[model samples]
Target: MAGLPQSSTYVSLTTFRRTGEAVPTPVWAAPDGDRLVVWTRADSGKVKRLRHTARVTVAPCDVRGRTTDEPVEATAVLLEPHEWRQARAALARRYGWQWRVSYASSKLWQRVTRPGIQRHAMIRVRPA
Candidate 1:
């Protein structure tokens, strides 16, 4: 599968429920070899859905989750803790300060609001 557009800052990640309903979310995506990596909260709906099924769809999109390109059928794998660290580092390199600020802000917000929220996870989506 071809890599995402160079100019794209976000991608719409679509994960499926057991009932096959699609849940789409806009997320920051970074190229990693043959897959695209995304960092998200561990307890997020997408992560929960991925636990039941690896099938997913990805497409260039705006922050609102509106697709800007045709979606690509893919399989999403949840990374282990160590791999999550590598993915986060790679994403930080690709996005520079933006990733850092967003990550820190999210952590701060979660601490303030959720108190005991789970740590974040990194997901790798490869072409199906």
Candidate 2:
């Protein structure tokens, strides 16, 4: 866990499917105490995969999903909505206006594409 980048802007979040396939994605991550907070779409494949498996691996990566460091074994959990405020606040602090603009844009897009339902979900990752 100590090896995982605490300040990395993009982390390759790899989640396991029920069939044990590894799906890796490049996502924004921000440190929150002992864990990292990741914001992603609610219906993303990674979120669906995590619903069935908690095993995960994370590494610092570029915008293209190419990892820049060795991956660290970890566990991930879907966070409850009540925890989102502070989690998102952490991201906003770390990413500054970019985070705000990106998130607001995502929400707006979601309203147009998938209205009347939550579009974003938060995942908390801890080094195992």
Candidate 3:
């Protein structure tokens, strides 16, 4: 399993719907040993789709999800609750200060606008 370049910051993650339709979303990803880890909202469509199937495709892309490299076949696994903290720490280390600021801002905003709505999950992607 070849890892993505160290400089790569974003990845386009494609998951399939029950009807076989492809849905692509650009997300921040950080290499975690032999796998890639991504953080997202727990109730997001991608997370829901992965519950049905792990099959997925990943590609280097810009922030808008425009693929900049060939897609790679992968399998995605939702992390357990106990692993979330480590995953968040890994993401903070990979993204540096920006992640800290963004996470803080998100927390503040959620508290102000939608209290008790902060549910998040981590997904691990391994090359197939």
Candidate 4:
């Protein structure tokens, strides 16, 4: 990984659609070794895009997805369940109470909206 920002509240994760359109979303990310770990819903559009391609870009950004830094080209991979847990643990260590609160609320929201369908994903991004 090279030139990937670590000191940011959020980052704009840009994923490409099958039509080659860029879709960027601001997300909380924590550095994990040489890569960055991002927590997100399993069915999010970014995950859908990742299913087709690993190519992505990351840049420091605001919560509203406005980029504040140059984008770094990267590749992302969806973690398996066990790896997801490990990756989430890394986020919890980095984000502390904020990660805990967000996790709890997301679970509650899932219960209310999707019933027993609780699914989440951890993305591992390696900058190029």
Q: Candidate 2: worst 10 consecutive residues by lDDT?
A: 1-10
Model 3 lDDT vs. the true structure?
0.86
Which residues of candidate 4, in runs, are more than 4 Å off? 109-116
User: Residues 1-128, candidate 4, lDDT per residue (tens digit)?
Assistant: 34787989899999999999999999999988878999998989999999999999999999999999889999999988777777888789889999999999988998988888747888999987
Go through the candidates in order and give each one's C-alpha lDDT: 0.86, 0.91, 0.86, 0.90
Candidate 3 per-residue lDDT over residues 67-109, each given as its tens digit? 9888888999999978878777878889999888977887788
Instruction: Between candidates 1 and 2, name the one with more favorable TM-score.
Output: 2
Clashes of each: 0, 0, 0, 0
RMSD of each: 2.4, 1.5, 2.0, 1.8
Q: Judging by TM-score against the true structure, name the best candidate.
A: 2
User: Could you give candidate 1's per-residue lDDT for residues 64-120 as a string of tens digits?
Assistant: 988988888899999987677778877887799999999899889889888886578
Task: Give model 3's TM-score versus the native structure.
Answer: 0.86
Candidate 4 overall lDDT versus native: 0.90
Predictions ranked by TM-score, top down?
A: 2, 4, 3, 1
**What TM-score goes with each of the models?**
0.85, 0.91, 0.86, 0.89
